[model samples]
Target: MQNKLYLDQRSNAFIILNLLMLWGWWMLYQLYALPVHYAKPYFALDKIPLYLEWSHLWFTTWLFVLLCICYLCTCLLLPHLQVAQVSVRWTLILSILGAGILNVMIYPVGAVDLFYYLTQIKLFAYYGENPYLTTFWPTYAHDELTPLSSFLSWPLVYGPAWLGLASLPIKFVGFDDLLTMLLAYKLFSLYCLLGCAWLIFKLLGGGAPGWYGAYVFAANPLVLFEAVANAHNDILLTLILLVALLGLRHRHILALPAFALAALVKVFILPLALGFAVALWRTRWPFRRIVGGSLCSLLIVFLLVAPFWGDGSIIERMQAAVEQQQTLRTAAPISLANEYAQTSGASAQQLEQLRIVFTASYGCLVLLALFFVRPLEHAMASIMLLLFLLVSSLFPWYLIPVFALLALHPRRLELGYMVVASLTGLLYYPLGVVAWQTEGLTLFQIQLVGATLLALPIVVFLVALLFQRRVELDQ
Candidate 1:
């Protein structure tokens, strides 16, 4: 009885800690408002005050510490609470909802991608301009919300399904009111986040595992910060992917159309769709049925793209956007290689060759996993992790879907790596703030540090796994 009481107290403390950390993050994001305002038009980090830099560093570090504690508590205490019949699941739901609300209120200081999403929706829905064909700048230079976006020159890089789904809330909120529009998008993302959690719970067959998986995705600070606060559409993509997976689990033919819809949100999901096809085949689905499913998927894609297909320039614009993204050297192994090439005076052709090699290797590994990995969820999780490591351009929010996938089949090693990667990946932002202010802190230096941070988790996980194996062998 005493132990039960003690377990209940720990569970309560965990809930309180999670809420407090989220509130702390909300407060920390508020500090970015002035800096964001000053850095408008391009969102460049130039001429920031020394005091603001120090404050950002201190506050970001403290928040991260709290986030680590929250994650650890979830990992260690959740199962115990479940055993004690502490009503922890309901508490988790309330805490997640509270966190979502707080995050929606916070400024999107982490990434200004939310502004770009709004601009695209406005261009398409309000101005009747095809976002795929038109750039945000020069065309809409005088618009009030133009200055808020950082991607001034890029056309629509997102898929049409995303545009179609994202347009609804902005239209309802009235695009003329920017604040309300922002709120609508944030709320939309929050809904998607919750939807992903619900699907995960349902997929896992509702019990301790289901609740744990739900909490893992819903309560993750990285998901809250990126999906709710920054309002990235990745959460929506994840939601669609989960829907597809759920359908597939039930052996429903509609899974194909759902997978197509998910792919239409982001082209990267094509590999997962391919994996889904393999799964269908392995299950001895009839050839004619597979063809019919494929047709349905293609039909859905056509319907989504038909409205945006203007004069065939949308294709060219999409290709251009892909090329533009390829040119960027960001947080990934390729980014580190690019830094090396610059310092070594290596030919650009060499770097291109390296990228091609990585791309090919990713394709091969994905094919192997599709054929060999048992259960579609594990295959999807492996594919997502491969994309994170092997893709030329990586972002922290890309891992949002990874958490959702991992939730479907929670393994300690993969989950721990993701948790660590999320933490280290986000270090890029605060590090950028300080890098801009401190003398001699170049972008190359930052990339190098980022690479090291990303690699640490892999090393630690590998070592721990090896030690565990050795112990088992001895036993």
Candidate 2:
């Protein structure tokens, strides 16, 4: 590939990053203008117009279309900017541009987890109901309130700390409108993304491959769209997980709180937590120190969560949370079967039959991860993580941490995971925009399954090569 001037190792990367930023901001401005004019006026989704005069509906629609095109252009530019060895100024500019586009799109489309995050918090803010104890908005929907706006279910699927963080926006952002809340959540997410970048830079001397970092994350349209644009708390949690993993690599005791807190925000990190705890145990920490530390982490999360949880019966609410969140690790074979059984409308008898099959399949994967997969321990752990993303229920932003790992440690085999995952994550965006029944996922999404399978052979080949390298090193 012929490299462009100043765009290659020749000139600064800072320039391109900034240019992308401007492009992204312009797109956001267009997004903010649209719903005020069109959505509120015509659909009355918000019905009450706050920003623009409802009469400007026609103009708002035009502006929204233009912004979508502009956002697309920005996305295309990011990959190139990432590949270029640009100056830091351009990098920051690009970073902000990425952030701008993310918040802009998140404010409008309402896809991904952005919706669930807001509605859950709004319940606590508007009515003073405990998010942990709240049921579907059906109770509120009857008071002439639109269920569409007030309706949220299963907020407890989120770990407790997530509720607190989501609640923080309620104070400053206010319950005045969804836009207010959307931006607030995204602002927090922006902080997380920056922290992840800084952490990666600190860990790897000479910096993680700049272009590689940008290409995999900083500039990926899917990441921007799902994380910042959509307000998925999973994005924030993913960063915490990444930071914690990097800390583990460095054996930073201080950073353990971040990982523990991450698990508090989302319980999906159970295996990673267990893995680390076991590693720690092997290092001979006293029983009390290990037990107390883990318990103390949970207690801290509870203290933060205590203010929001009310309605007395704490244990009942806790029990309810446990029942509702049963399938969080759904990609695990047993959990996947349970989810499939529930959603596919199978009979209880059928479910019981399927459980046996699921248990057996999961046992096989566990065995592979533990033993036969020794050479690719890291890679196997990663596969288990990816399996957690698929087969199980997952919010799009949940893919962020694993993607960070891949971006930092990309072998040819893992890059294949990146490409497929990036596409699947992108597909999630349109679900909120296009009518679901109309956009019904096509077979192309199936293309990822193919990529995964074909890529496995390469993964196996890579494993062989790594073993060879290890033998040579031993000599």
Candidate 3:
């Protein structure tokens, strides 16, 4: 009876904390209205007074910490709680759904990538232009949504599958209504987020582990912030990846085509698909079955890209998009290295050489890990982590796949690392904001802080691993 009471109290506390976090987000939405233009004046960082800036920072920090606490509590409480109970199951479902809806209402104050997503879909849907081949600049300079898009000159960086799916809401809402379109995208993302959570729950076989996995993906603050609040397309990619994983387990042949479709959402998953193909070959599937699956996968990819192929070479356009993405030097170790190089008067050629080396090294590491890592999900998680660590353009939402994969195979070390990473990944934004605004702070100093944030999770993971090994040896 006492234990049951304790569980109820903890459950109630979890519900209240989530409500508080949602309220905080609502308040934040009101505090910082959507920007007229998504640029340097983002979140009105420059125009806002020092007090308001500090207030936003403090509020955001508190919410982040509170979110971490809630997630940690969920991790603890899930193991003991009886998810078999109807009320318990419904509570989990309703809480996730409620939080997602509230997040849809909140403006994407963290990043304006959603606007870019809208612009690309609008370009394709309304303007009769191929998003993959066309840039949304000089041509659509006066368009209402153009000013809001950060990537005005770059071609669509995402794959055709996402573009096609995202276009539906824009088509329904139409271009005349900007606010509605934004809401539509938010709603679309919320649905995808919910889909991911549901899929995770189903994949884990609907017990304690199922509930735990679902909560880990859905209740996570970072996932909510990026997937719903910011409305990133990573949620869509994650959903498709989960579908692919489900198919891989049930109908082996279905996995290939599903993975192909997933890669169409984001090319990063292509490596995993390749690894899957290799795994299939190693398993010694019949030659005819292998050929049939390969053909089906190819057909899916071809059909998805065919509509947007236009007159330009799709391969060339894809390469250009990849290059454009690489040019972005966000909160990654390479970004820090580039910053230091610039401050120290290092040559551009030298930096390029270093980048080449890093890229090649990462590619090799991924190949080896794919070959060696047992089980498909572990390989996916490991590769995603490698991408986060090695890539130059690191964003918080990129960790979405990591969280999704961890849901399937929740190892202690990776799970703990990712939970910590979600926090540190978010810290980059506020730290960058303060570092940039503070006078006399060097660019190198700013990048150094980002590098430190990037490194902290890895350091913690390593230390924990070492301690675990020591404990096992002592025993």
Q: Name the regions of candidate 1 deviating beyond 4 angstroms.
A: 29-53, 83-87, 371-375, 455-475
**CA displacement after TM-score superposition, residue 277 of candidate 1 (Å):** 2.4
Candidate 2: C-alpha RMSD to true structure equals 7.5
lDDT of 3 by residue, 1-475 (tens): 9988988887676566666666656665665544332333233333445435487677766667776766666666666777776766777777788778777876676788888888888888899998777788878988887666677788788888898899998898888877788888999999999899889989999778888888888988789888998898999999988887786666467677878888888887666766676667666766776677779989988888888777657778878988888767666676667767877888989988878877887798678667666556766666766666676467788888878987786667766776788787766667767877789977778767776776557546645644654676679
lDDT by residue for model 2 (1-475), tens: 5665534542343344345545544554454543353223122213324324534443434433443343344433444454323464356545655554445543434343455566666666677777677654664654322333422555456766777666886677777765555566777777776666655554444243544454445555445655665556767787777666665555555346767788777666655654566446555555665566567666776786667556455446655666665545322334544654676788988977876665465455544443333223244354445344333344445567666655565454555555544554443333222322235553333323333333333345436535645665679
Q: What is each predicted model's overall lDDT from 0 to 1?
A: 0.76, 0.52, 0.75
Structural similarity to truth (TM-score) of each candidate = 0.90, 0.67, 0.90
Encode model 1's per-residue lDDT on 1-475: one tens digit a residue. 9987897798788777767766666675566443344235433233334346476567766686678567766766686676335556667877789888878876676778888888888888988998898877889888877877867688798899999999999888797667788789999999999899899989999888888888888888788888998788999999999998887878777888998999888887777867786778677777776788789998998899888888787888887897788667566776666677777888889878878887898888778666555456766766766675676466778878877876786677657776786677666567656665568877787766655666456446545544554566679
Per-residue lDDT, model 1, residue 85, is: 59
lDDT of 3 at 243: 87
Give candidate 2 misplaced runs (Cα > 4 Å). 1-89, 92-102, 105-112, 136-139, 142-155, 205-215, 254-256, 281-292, 305-346, 363-367, 370-391, 428-475
Model 3, TM vs. native:
0.90
How many Å off is the CA of 147 in candidate 3? 2.0
Candidate 3 stretches greater than 4 Å from native: 32-41, 44-53, 281-286, 371-375, 458-475
lDDT of 2 at 48: 29
